[model samples]
Target: MTSSQIQVPAQEEGGATILEIGQQPDAWREVGGETDEGLARFLRGITERPGLRVILTGAGSSAFIGQIAAPALRRHLGCRVEPIATTDIVAAPRDHLEPDTPTLMVSFGRSGNSPESLATTALADELVTDIWHLVYTCDRTGELGRAHRDRANSRVVYLPERTNDTGFAMTSSLTSMLLSCLLTLGPAGRGNVEALAQAAEHVATLQPDIRALAQSGPQRIVYLGSGALAGLAQESALKLLELTAGVVVTYFDSPLGFRHGPKSVLDGCTLVVVYVSNDPYTRRYDLDIVAELRAQLSPDAVRVLSCEPIPQELGTATVLPGLAHLDDAQAALPYLVFAQYLALFTALEHGKTPDNPFPSGEVSRVVQGVTIHPISPSDLEAR
Candidate 1:
């Protein structure tokens, strides 16, 4: 169903998430129109500097995008590109920051209002001498978004207007910003539009099936993947846990890691979703885990998402379609559509609103109650 078409109890209306999720295909197309020459020069600048370091920073789902992008981008740039959360940087700047190294702090935020996002940027300005900012956000109007638009070394990439999510949870906002980073980082992201278009069209057709599967009300959920998909797996887990308000127990880890101590969580009622990696080597481990889980649990217990044709041959497992034509980084957007739908349908099954999942005032659309304390000179010295 389209976002606006989703029906929930009057007390639990959640149209924002549904609409956000549905509009992602459009957001994918729209964000492509934006271009920043300064941002382009900064990317080239990284290659020219000998000791330059790139730090991809954000909070919550925004942070996960950094995890997904850093590894791929590091290889693409052939330099040190690290994914460190603004949450961590704000709390302990000494370990993550260095005044001697030329640093580029790439900040990803949905609203750009979170105290830490800007606070972390501020900290960089104070502690690092040769610091630059490349900020990609859905809301160019928010405090962090507008704060540094004129900085000589900084570049702000404001995505399509529709991407600034009105929903409590980030749907288009998350994927679009993540896609933007991938698009900026390397060749892998350059070909994403064609692949994302196909995947979006494909996902639109599968919503009914996905919704039906989610209504079964599995008591527990597990998401597994390898490489960049591993980070997306964590974001998916967070989406469900937040939407369900902790009513459902969820866990995320890599396929091989699941076998170590985590495999005990599996049971008859547990639904396991595996994001089959686009990498051939990683795909083998993913398939192996699926085989093991299906053999140990029922074949019905495990679900695999992949672009591989061979998964169709696995009779015991349910295979969700993926965009195999795109590389892992470029294809992450389409693969994430499945996770977004799962969270949406799962929340609705319980008559809960996916948009504003938590009314307890405990969790919020924007993180609240944060105290951005000043980092002292003493704190700057690494212990």
Candidate 2:
């Protein structure tokens, strides 16, 4: 399908159309005007619960959302925060949940109907006492949202209608839920979420260049990050694989971690995308990796794109315009947007539809095939 086929509702002649999917950052400004009372009430309920251990859960891209939010939530809310994938929670419940822990589980899902999504929610209900559920889902009437409505200690926040993207891959829904999580749980005073949204608008304007890199056919893609973005690296890798129908082999690792053995994966046909942190200490390690890679570069060995600009010595193409020391999650959006564009272009490059890369049905928008198991009493005790 052509890019126009997936055009966003707020499409402007020169504004960023790619970034407009999933509740655009600008759309959050209307949160209070449109649903302020609900958001306020939701926040109040979550914050009032003393000694609450928050578990953020989802699958695939959804799961990565939790990964990005976990550390920031802990730092901002001063609560015990954990990011557990629903897949893991379903396969092994005892490791993640504890009966005695007064838990608040925030679920992120695009369609709200993945079997693992349902299984994770059901397991939480079965295992925890004083359970509070906050579901952020794109589908308003999907299983997870409907099942939790009117139930005590359960609330569902359906994303804006525009965010319910029909494309096989998630673009708008991911950013919307991500922003929602950041606003609700991150260090709010550090920066305005609206400013971050505006930045997203800026990045959206650069889709053409970002998409070109993906179409250039670098045989492999490596995504690197540190701290909260470590999870983002993994998600970026997965997105490329899914959007390209696994035509591209992608890998992810921490900046420092890559040197141990993974660095060997780099070669002439690889495209290395690094998500550099703004923290001076963290950036040092990330920059070191880039320097090492450059030092080892052979003519036409690999094409490296640093998501943010680094010192010239690093020798890599900087893709997105730099954000001045924004919070990691906020900074991540620009990088994430670029990655999405790359995936879309990669699908197109392979003579595949950018909107629906998997036509034969091996993969899906909402995942399929899973079983939810009962939580045992012993499992409850250990949570």
TM-score of every model versus the real structure = 0.93, 0.87
Give me the overall lDDT of model 2: 0.73
Model 1 Cα lDDT, one tens digit per residue, 234-289: 98899888888888899999999998999899877899988887788888998888
Candidate 2 segments exceeding 4 Å error: 1-35, 38-42, 48-50, 189-191, 298-309, 316-322, 374-383
Off by over 4 Å in 1: 1-14, 189-191, 311-313, 316-322
What C-alpha lDDT, on a 0 to 100 scale, does residue 66 get in candidate 1? 88
Best by TM-score: 1
- Where is the poorest 10-residue window by lDDT in model 1? 313-322
Tell me the TM-score of model 2: 0.87
Q: Look at candidate 1 and tell me the lDDT of residue 28.
A: 87
